[model samples]
Target: MKPLTVIGFLGSTLDASKFGPSRWSKWRPSVALTMHEDLRVDRFVMLHGTPHARLAEYIAEDIASISPETTVDRRVLDLVDPWDFEEVYGKLLDFARAYPFDPDAEDYLIHITTGTHVAQICLFLLTEAHYLPGRLLQTQPAKRGEDGGAPGRWTSIDLDLSRYDSIATRFAAASAESTSFLKSGIDTKNAPFNRLIDEIEQVAVRSRAPVLLIGPTGAGKSQLARRIYELKKLKHQVQGPFVEVNCATLKGDGAMSALFGHKKGAFTGAAADRPGLLRTADTGMLFLDEIGELGLDEQAMILRAIEDKRFLPVGADKEVSSDFQLIAGTNRDLGRAVAEGRFRDDLYARLNLWTFALPGLAERREDIEPNLDYELDRFAEREGTRVTFNKEARERYLAFATSLDAIWAGNFRDLAASVTRMATFSPKGRIDSDCVASEIARLTRLWASDTKGDDDGLDPLLGDVALAALDPFDRVQLAHVVATCRRSRSLSEAGRALFAASRARRTSSNDADRLRKYLTRFGLEWGQVSG
Candidate 1:
């Protein structure tokens, strides 16, 4: 076994005594610590200031006399004010850094019974941080009934709490709770989405930097942003109010006035001095939804505000400061926008530091079931009427919703609306098969109408005669394929998106060739469909 080493401060009052055997009658922590038969410390590192040098030497000699085999190493730690936390911690930290610690050969113990409270705390922190690689040794004086002169009891506390199952379990539970809170307690099951949320939870709690959420509309970007703010508030990271703004609604001069605040007489509508959304969110959070919709000028201003925390209002020479954490949400591709000269590259770079892309409902089909139940619970709370689907109806709705044919154009919004409609039209409180069937048909019609709006491109590509001969299923499928092709950069990308689920099962697959053959069957080519 490795030799035991004890490192502690010299207790000026507790360890002081005249040069005689009578000193043994009085219990000195340092002297009694060496007398313990079980704890055979091979080395005792005694620390003290310049004023306590003589006392440190006297205690070292006494400890040596008691246990001649033990080596007592005296260290001088000069401190101006022992009560000052910063000074004490800094001095100890420096000492710990300079000390040679050999954990492999020596079992180290930090004695906490011989220092100021500040020094004890600093020692605990250093040990916890592993600067002092050892366990804490807390010594208590003997009880009143016990022998007052005898060496007191000592307990060793390991800083690595994972060794203790109860402590480890509690920490894990707390972490899971934090992640669940960030997800708004939805219990999402999608593996990628769950991992993303876990990473987001860590970043949200630790960072005040700008975060950019990228996803399609109704993918819950705004809701997620609000949840992040709420989580931060729960952690006491922010004290100000959560200020949310939809940049899509702001236009030209109004956008500037609303965001950066305008001085009196700045514009025709600006009659009074207005503190903008940024100022209102001071020392808090600012969520800018549909951020990509903002104009180039506004984007530049926002970048300045984020970086410098100060910006000038309209018609004002002076600058106003607002230190707010920014959370930007956008469906549009800012990188593409930057390439097209629409968005400022600098602003995009700034916001892209901590960017997270949320998957749409279609991508996370497994999560839809939980979110469905959540939506129903929300409806019950809002309407003060509980509603549920029968077994068959619930299974039928889930089957259709999870199927590839169901196009969730509005993502979660569409799911919520469908649940609301079915709940409202259900006979009594329970949704029967008839209600679910009618809701499904209604959703199909709505999705079909949306597809038809984009079907104009189909007529021109397929021509009148070819389109007239095709069946309704063929027409709809071909129209969707052609539309996807037009939107994608290449045939391969379109095929990958079109066959995302099936492609995973194939060991050796050529999506481009498969797409080429499918297009050939319909007398269409990549150039014609993509063009």
Candidate 2:
């Protein structure tokens, strides 16, 4: 076996126990290094501040006497304040970088019992970063009656906590709590959605890759992106502002200038130089909502920006660079757009690396109550007054919200608006049964008008013969699917959106095939529905 090497700080006052009258006393950590049989310290690199140098020498002499085979190398490291994190961390990092590490010949360990908390933390950071490659050797005071009540006991702690079952369990719990935090306290009942959020949390923390959120409008893509940005900000991963833009709102030269900046005399309204959204997103995140609506020219520029981190501004000779994480949100079927020669295929391939499809409010009906409470809480905060639903009113509202007939086409946005209106119109800061009834009536009317006078566009699409042949339930489901497909850029996109729940449970995800089969049952084809 390779000899064990230890790198550590000499305990200034603590190491003096070696010279005490009692030779068998186990108070000092340095003297305890030779207590183990199988574990032997071949070489010790002792680091000490100016005042601790003498103590270090004395400890080194004692170590040499106790273990004649062990080599001792002592060095004086002056730290103004061992408690100051930055100063100690920088000095230790510099030392580690300069140290000759021979991994093939010796197994290294960091003795953490001799330093201040700050120094210990720095050592941990360096080891975890592999700047100093080694496990940690922490010396702890032995429990009473344990090993004859000895003072110092050496324990090795690996950086990967999976070696300890208890630590791993605690870490997993902490991770789950963090994932829940990212979801804004909405403990969703949908298992798949929860798992997706968990995966997203891991990805957001670990990578700087571009994330694509594909879901229908008001499905919380934009909100989730902002939450991710907040999480990263809390971790200090990103420092710049979160820049957001709706691509559908941009047009022509304005779109180019807004996204990629402009030269002083670039266009008609170019009064001064402008540093675009991409530049504004430096060291941060850029959220492009309705990304599918961007023109081909803009799409190509965005692709280049995402891939190379550089893009040419409108009418500029030089290309500007912005290092930013991209989070693109779209309700359109990008695959169909690619097939139809709208969205670039190369860009689709790049963005598809980490694509997550969000389910709408209708699909996650079980989570309606929690989301309702959340919306109410948000409403109270925004309006600067607390407004709550009475027990009966809340239950009634939840039931109505999650019902099959209530088509939440606008999803969370609509839900927020409903809560806002009800709270604003409520009496004495409480929503009673009458208030819920009125809100329900208002929503029903709004939805009825939205679907074009309650027929829901079914009559026109089905025709009399086809409409009469199918059962009412099948007709409703089929009509909804047809509407989704018509709005979708491709059949697969529509299928994924429509059968999101079914696809979650399916081991083999052939969404397009399943959708095609369902459409055929209704005497429908991709061409007919798309047209």
Candidate with top TM-score is 1
Number of clashes found in candidate 1: 0
User: Each candidate: what lDDT?
Assistant: 0.84, 0.80
User: After aligning candidate 2 to the native by TM-score, how far in Å is the CA of 513 from where it should be?
Assistant: 24
Model 2: worst 10 consecutive residues (lDDT sum): 163-172
lDDT of 2 by residue, 161-216 (tens): 21111211000011234337678877688788899898889999998988999999
Which structure among the candidates has the greatest lDDT? 1
Clashes of 2: 0
lDDT of 1 at 499: 86
Window of ten residues with lowest summed lDDT in model 1: 163-172
